[model samples]
Target chain A: MASAIINGMPVEITPGETILEAAKKLSVKIPVLCKHPDLDATAACGICVVKIKATGRTLRACCTPIDSGMDIVTEDAELVQVRREVLELIMSKHPNECVTCARNQNCELQTLCADFDIRHMELPSLVPDIAKDTSNGTIELDPRKCVTCGRCVQVCQEKQNVWALSFLDRGIDTRIAPAGDISMAESPCVSCGQCSAHCPTGAIVECDETQKVWDKLIDPDVVCVAQIAPAVRVALGEAFGFAPGTNVTGKIYASFRRMGFKAVFDTNYGADVTIMEEGTEFVERFAHGKGALPLITSCCPAWVDFMEKYHNDMIPHFSSCKSPHEMVGALTKTYWAEREKIDPKKIFVLSVMPCTAKKWEVRRSADMSSSGYQDVDVSITTRELARMIKQAGIDFATIPEAQPDHLLGAYTGAGTIFGATGGVMEAAIRSALFLITGKNAANPNFEFTRGLKGIKTGSMQVAGKEVRIAVAHGLGNVETVLDEIRKAKAEGKEPPWHFVEVMACPGGCVGGGGQPYGVTDELRLKRAKGLYQEDGATLWRCSHDNPYVQQLYKEYLGKPLSEKSHHLLHTHYVQRPTYRR
Target chain B: MTTATTPNVQEDLQRIAKKWKDKPGSLIMVLHEVQERLGCVPRNVCLELAKLIDVPVARIYEVVTFYNYFKTEAPGKHILSVCTGTACHLKGASKVLESLSKELGIKEGESSADKEFHLQSVRCVGCCGMAPVVMVNGAIHGKLKPESSGKEIVAQYRGK
Candidate 1:
């Protein structure tokens, strides 16, 4: 190893290490777009140019190696000017639409521009006439705004392992698009929204539903009741400048009130209902040998969609219960409306989701209301709701902490954990234990399924039978788990798990596509902490103990799988075309 | 055409259901197999599968519509999957896509009027070193240049 003295710091470097790598070893930050750690260094950005002590020439630090005695100045005036010029050149061809663009506040390029104070473009703007792509269900792409950073491409190919987006054409005609310019819906996008998440500009964004939600709010006939998912509370705060794990449940309720919503409800209530129906369904399946073994969860729309299209062979394994948000919407019209003597036709259900799939979830004809209205009239992302709150000039942090409206707003800690990957399974165990053993669980925390593990499996004896369960989040993880199960079945071994929970996002609902921007491993765990804390703080931690749910079963619904419950709370799955274009 | 009776769809679903009756999540697996065989996921198949699985039919329908990949209608003869991964972006995959769309005279995700070609974009195919990759009927083609004068990719598929 060779040692170098740069910027008054002694840094040890490998034989042929670059000045940039040595600088990084000394805890120095060198900003360069074209100098990704994984990608081969092109040094085209020129932002990482550094001044050498002895040599008058400014060298591209990313590509240049550090000699043992080399002394480098990364923040000299000449280097600063060179970096500024480089950024300006990059900005010349970039769209100046950050003010009103979808990625306006959340863009990395815009942030860099602000940081460098490069307000005006000295060079001529190359405004290409490119049509925007609204063909995708989850994200829209604006070609004119693309800087061709290839971050979306890198993430799609390297991170998500889904190589759907790519750049095409020569020079001025170059634009990012799917191979063969296919509609994203027809593409194998999987609606992960990672492309939009990684995009440095407004080139990509989750489909905008802000105006539609506002329009519904103004319609007097539409008594809009908003339901916020468990994950939304943890991540929604990030859009409003709150810390990642900050619990914004109270703030969300207050903001919805300010937004003119008739009632603020919790999707966890619906989650609780899902647990009841899904748990009972699982029990029935196990007892009667009715449905598939090792029933998989159906709450994640993305997972459901994936199974329907690519893995329809696994449909019987999916539980027949609707997602928590849809369940809440369905019950709001049926169970809640009947209780309040409100017309189901007048009520509008809005879900504040952390998922793009929720948009598709609400559109299913099978999830329609018996009252002839869409069960969930609108689905808005956590980001969208944050925009609305900001647009209204409401101080989210200062808003009076308010509790959700009665009954539907009330949820147990188990329900709150439904936001994380293993939350659904943990919540189910709490209730399932009570259902089976007729007592409080010996261990309230099913710690086996908790944390950031990609896939977790646990088995517990209930009524002398080992009830095995597996929890998986993210589509990639789901594929691995399914593959394992397939292999097991091929070996003639009984499936290891009786119930499984799958969330499409990496960390479950907390990391949903529609969640607040800039999600990291630390942020997901923080959000998960908030969820578990909320679960621990709640009195009724078990689904079976939820009084409102108990009342619904006793009064309106009769039982979990009763004929009325089946028509309303419980739903079905459909096999989709395997070979989609 | 078969009548829209529940039993009819059940019979269609049973054809596949009988194959995976004992497997875990057999209903979903059978549905996938049937969809693979049928080109489109028919409502009758879903209904029959739901009944066989003993879950509510609504749940089955919900899963079908919730995902973007699931198609409720029949597909065309040839499936064209364009690669949109990062390496392809650097190699100008978008222009290749545009050229294909123009050559095919149809938008992405659309079947040709003749019902011969169905175009779609897929996430990464794990072939970053080879930028601008396209998978037509599962055959991977790399380093594609979308030239106006070039022989249209769809024409070759039509001849096939």
Candidate 2:
């Protein structure tokens, strides 16, 4: 450990910890423009420069590792002047249309400028004239407002392993663009929306589809049906003054009702249905040897798109079961429509997902309309839902808590945990054991299948057979697991895993690309802990124990893989080229 | 698709990949070899190279756009580069570039409409003594009237 005297305060620094991190311990905010807590410091902005008394030189605090005997002054008149100049320069390049920008109040750059008390720009504006690229439909790239922070590009290329974005050209012309200047729709983008999640400026953001939902809600004949995803409950409270991990499921249901929805359902109930179908499929494969071993979960649409684009060879291993939201959407249009005596065409299902890819997933294929209409009419993000709640003038805190609609709303612990990484594997194992042995495991919580480890692998005793399983999140970590599976298969060896679960974003749905901004590892864990707490509190810990899910299978769909279940609850995949052209 | 004139572009790229595919910092090396043969790198060829090298197409484009040596679009029948080094700039290189652009009816770093002349400004050509040099198809014309030489040299190529 390196000890340093930072800003007249003694601090202990661990190895590889930067000066910025060291300052953070002492409650000293070393202002950074391009530095994110989750990413390595690119040192592109040059705003976090701090003076070293010993060397008599300023170093970028974000990248400079603290050394012993270093006397660092993070704040001084001179340092403030330098940082002010840097901010002014950055603002000069940034567009002057902050009033019209989506990130007007929530932007990091705007916050930094406020901290520095920057009054007016000394330098002239030199913002680019590039047109906004809404080609991706799920995300927008407003190049004119870009400060060239490289956060979005780093997250896309390194964190997600989808190299659809790049810092094209150099010097004054340097800007983020989909590779080869091709539209993001044609590029190898999975529509995870992580770029928007990490972007500090208005350069990248989730495509605002709130207007479309509002229009549908105002339609005279259209019935606005809403479903909230498992991850949304634990995160949507952040828009209000609630803490990060607060469970506002009841509050969110009430808010949706207050905002004008005919019925408010929970996506967790859909997740239970997914577990029923996915667990049955796993049992058939493991016990009766029906289909492919190592059945990969397809609930995360971003991961599904990634698998199809980058690793289509694993198509046989991918579970054909539709994601929970789509399952709920399809069922809402069919069974719910038939039972409610409403016209299926007039019923509009809008899912409030913790994902942006669900926007694209709604229109993926004809199978999405197995209920004779589009399964999901529209998919809004958790962030967008929060905006709509406020726009509807609903006092979230004052609203009385209410329960979700019974027919498609009841969920067990197994379904709720789907928001966390390794959650699907844990939830599936909980019910799969019962499907195979007719008994639930004593301990529903699988400690090995938790946390932010890139790839998790383990084996469990199932009906006297050792079933190997693996869980992977953050698209970059999946290649390692898939390569291992490929190596085993190529040599005709026993499959290394009998089951696999994948989520494209870092911390499953809880840390999705469409969640709140300023997300870090600590926040991810906190948000995931909220889901786990919900899981712990619920009486029914296994998906098989969810009575409402069982009733649905018995009444509407005959069984998990029955003809009607396959028709409305499963989907297919196609090997798509990385470049559409 | 690769241009028809370079029918063996695929095999040539495969050969380059064989030489540098597994090596680190080999993107620029492979690109140099491709540029040596093709005069300019096409987007489709880079997309193909991305697969052969097991790198993303965006990465190839990042490197290709960075360096001034590699051209993405096909160059004209005649390539013209005006030296803009410190020595050349002091010797009126801007005037030389201006006259060339006027005669060619295209800006710097762009090709003419007829695709007969490609003009670009270069940092240095390693001949500071030949200040304000204009390279026409690799034949350097130096130490002349900046205005006349730029127009006169391209006129020579046009007449031929």
Candidate 3:
């Protein structure tokens, strides 16, 4: 332990803790721009500079480790002056397009400027006219607005291990770009949006599709139907006054109605349908000795894209089921459209997702067009949906609670928990056991496969046969789990797992790229807790128990892997080139 | 002086990697060796080095771009460097650079059409007394005026 006096207040801290972090423990507020709770301090922005009374030197509080017996003054007259000068210098190079920027109200730079009471423009502004890149159609990269904080670069390379973003040149000419100066589409970007998630400014953000949705909503010819993802329900409340994990699914349904959507559905319904398909496939592989062993979930589109590019060998193991939102989209276009006597072509299916990858996934292949038109017309992120709610002047917090449309709306507790890490695996296990033994899972919770661990392993006994399961979230963490299986396969040894579930974003979809910004583990846990609570409070706790799902199988789709289900619910993947050129 | 094929570049990068094998923070040193042999570190060479050294290509590019010493383009046969330091600048080094550029018909930092010479501006060469210094291939010429003397130096190099 290291003891220090911060502003004449003695504080104890652990070794290797940064002074900024120590000060945070002591409730000291040190302003920082480049430092983020989710990333390591780059010290790129020098605003968090502090003076040491004994040494008479100013050090960056974000990166500098505190030493014992250190006398530190975080805020003094000279420190404030230097910090202000640093901010002015940063602002000089940054574009003053805040009013027109996407992050107009929520930008960290704007917040800091307000806190410091910056009034005058002391330095000559030099905003370089770097072109905006909208190549991927999922996220936009405006290099002109970039502050070069290195947070996006850090998240891309270190945390996500994507290596899609990097500093291209030196010093003042330094700009964040794809590593080899290629477009984002050409790079190995999975369109995960973690870069946008970690960015402090409006330099990187989701491609706004709210205007298109609004256009469709106001059109007399268009019958707009919306579906909210499991993760969206848990995290959308953060945009309002509610806490991070507060489940406002009911309020969201009401909001969609006010926003002019004809009907609102829940992606949890699709999640239940996915378990039916994936669980059956797992049983066939494990019990019937058909298909590949260790079936991997294919719900997360970013993970699917990552597999198609980096780990193509794992393609056979990937479950052919479409993601939950896509499933709901297909059902809405075909099943719901037919039931309501509406034209499938005229039905505009919109998906509200907690993922940027979903925006790309909508137009990925013909399978998304299985209903004769695109299964989903527009996929808006949870953040985009929040903006739409605000734009419509709907008080989200006080909105009356309403239920989703009855056709594809009813879901189970297993579906609600799909927002969290290890959730899909747990949901799959609950149904896979029922498929094998012809009975409901003894313990529907599947308690072993839950939490924020990067990779989790557990075992379940189905029909007196042991089934090994592994769950991994975060693209970087997927490598270790994959390498282990590859090594075992090469050595002709027993496989490490019989089933695997992977979510590309850290902490699953709750900590997704398009979730509320400024996410931390605490927020991920709270959001995950909200889902689990919804699961516990629900009448039906198993996917197989969803009456609507059973009705779908009985009325439209014959069975889990029937030809109709395979045509509409399943999709194929091809090995993709990492670079477009 | 030479362009390396795919196999040759891989082999050369492998040799460089062997020298820095099991060494921590040796990517920059390996990259230096690659630039020394090939005149510049090309994209393929960087990819090869990243594979051999078990580092990401993005990280290699980060290190390469951070240092101005590392060149990404092949340099010319005879490099002409004019000192642009404070002392040299005060002594009309900019005018000397201008005259040299006009005489050679090539802008600063560009190679001549014949691929013989490349003009560049640099900081001090550690001799303030010899302000307005020009170095051609490490042979320093001091105290040369921008007018005729700088043009004569370019003409001399052209004839070589």
Q: Pick the candidate with the highest lDDT.
A: 2
* Top-down lDDT ranking: 2, 3, 1
Better of 1 and 3 by DockQ: 3
Best by TM-score: 2
Looking at candidate 3 chain A, the ten consecutive residues that score lowest on lDDT are A441-450
lDDT for each of the candidates?
0.77, 0.90, 0.89
Q: Which predicted model would earn the best DockQ?
A: 2
DockQ of 2: 0.67
Worst 10 residues of 3 chain B by lDDT: B1-10
What TM-score does prediction 2 earn? 0.97
Deviation (Å) of A184 in candidate 1: 1.5
**Where does model 2 exceed 4 Å of error?**
B1-7, B124-132, B143-150
> Which runs in model 1 stand beyond 4 Å of their true positions?
A1-6, A11-27, A32-73, A161-163, A169-174, A578-580, B1-160
> Candidate 1 - CAPRI tier?
incorrect
CA error at residue A289 for candidate 1, angstroms: 2.8
Candidate 3: CAPRI quality band: acceptable
Each model's TM-score? 0.73, 0.97, 0.95
Error of 2 at A425 (Å): 1.1
Compute the DockQ of candidate 1: 0.03
Per-residue lDDT tens digits of candidate 2, residues A1-581? 55889988899988888899889999998888898887999999999999987676999999999998789999889999999999999999888777888888889999999999988988988888898999878988999888898999999999999999999999988999987778889889999999999999889888889999889889889998999998898999998978998999999989878878999888999999999999999998889999888899999999999999999999999899999999999999988999999999999899999899999999999989999999998998999988899899999988889998989999999999999999999999999999999998989989889999988889988878999999999999999999999999999998999999999999899999899888999999999999999999998999989999988988899889999999999999999888886
